[model samples]
Target: MKIGELSHLTGVSVRSLRHYEKKGLIASVRLPNGYRDYSPLTTETVDTIKLYLNLGLTTEQIAAFLTCVLKNKEAFCAEVLPVYRKKLADIEHQLKQLDQIKTNLIDRINSLQQEEQVKNE
Candidate 1:
């Protein structure tokens, strides 16, 4: 199929499909007329890519194990375990930082409320 058909099947934009091709996350062949041709299996690859992106994985990270997963027809490859762990750790760290920020905001709000109460008294 052509690029447009792939885009329609995957519900991904043409620009994003080109971007995926450029990122080496997906592959296509060029026809004599300069139009890009994609395999029907490319639809499954695009869906997989979208799943990883939704999980907050970057294309570079996905590229690291996408082929393995695809070739093996597995949910994940051995190489992706470390990536998943690292991403989880990063998210945990961010959650801690956000919690600290939330605490500070609460303290500041309480302090201001106390000051207002005193002023009104």
Candidate 2:
């Protein structure tokens, strides 16, 4: 299929599909007329790419995962476990930071409410 068809089937925008090709996350062959031709398997590959992206994996990380899945494993390669763990740890750290920010915001809201009550009294 062509790029447009791939985009339509995958629910990903044409622009993003092109970006994926450029980033080496996906592959396409150029026809004589300079149009991109994608294999049917590219759809499944796109799904994997999107799943990794939604999980907070970067393009470089996704590229590594893609390499493993394309192999005989049929999924992310077990060899990449350490890399995935590192990314998971990074996300956990960010979650902790966000939790702290949330607590601070709640505290500020409570303090403002107390001030408002004092002013009205």
Candidate 3:
């Protein structure tokens, strides 16, 4: 199939498909007429790419383990484990930072409110 067909089947934009190709996350062959031709299996690859993106993994990270997953038909390949662990750790760190910010904001609000109450008396 052509790039357009792949995009339609995958519900991904043509530009994004091109970007994925450029990132080495996906590939296509050029036809004699110069149009890009993608295999039917590319749809599955695109879906996998989208799934990883939704999990907050960058294309670069996905590329590192995608081939293992696709070729072996196992999402939990050895190469993927470290990447998953790192991403989870990163998310946990962000959550801790956000919690600190929330606590600070609440403390500031309470202090301001107390000052306002004193001024009213």
Candidate 4:
């Protein structure tokens, strides 16, 4: 398909697609008529790239992942698994912090309510 069709399918802007091309994340070929042609596989590739981008993976990380995928599929799984584990750990830590904050706020509110009752009496 063409860039317009790819953009519509991937929901990625033309400029972002160009940027991905420049980053070596995706490829495009020039037709004899000077229009760029995209491969059908590019749709899945761009979707993977966008997923990593949304997950806070940098361009360098994405490149490393692509390289791993090219070299060994099992190795790519190994690399991605570690990243997912780390993200899970970070999320758990944040959840613990939020729970602590919630507990502190509830305690403070209860104390304030008790003090107000004592003053009323």
Q: Can you give the lDDT of residue 18 in candidate 4?
A: 88
lDDT of 3 by residue, 1-121 (tens): 9999999999999999999999998989999999999998999999999999999999999999899889886555888888889999999999999999999999999999999999999
Q: Native-vs-model 3 lDDT? A: 0.93
Which lDDT tens digits does candidate 1 get at residues 1-121? 9999999999999999999999998899999999999999999999999999998999999999999988985554788889989999999999999999999999999999999999999
Model 1 ranges off by over 4 Å: none
Please tell me which model should have the higher TM-score, number 2 or number 4: 2
Per-candidate local distance difference test: 0.93, 0.87, 0.93, 0.84
lDDT of 2 by residue, 18-121 (tens): 99998999889999999999999999999988887887788888786687776657444775687678988998999999999999999999999999999999
Q: Candidate 3: list runs displaced more than 4 Å.
A: none
How many pairs in model 3 have backbone atoms within 3 A of each other, for residues 3 or more apart or on separate chains, i.e. clashes?
0
Error of 1 at 81 (Å): 0.5
Worst 10 residues of 2 by lDDT: 71-80
Error of 2 at 22 (Å): 0.6
Candidates 1 and 4 compared by TM-score, better number: 1
**Candidate 4 lDDT trough over 10 residues, lowest sum:** 67-76
TM-score per model over all chains? 0.93, 0.87, 0.92, 0.61
Per-residue lDDT of candidate 4, residues 1-121 (tens digit):
8999999999999998988889898898999998889999999888878888898767767876765664566344667777767777888899999999999999999999999999999
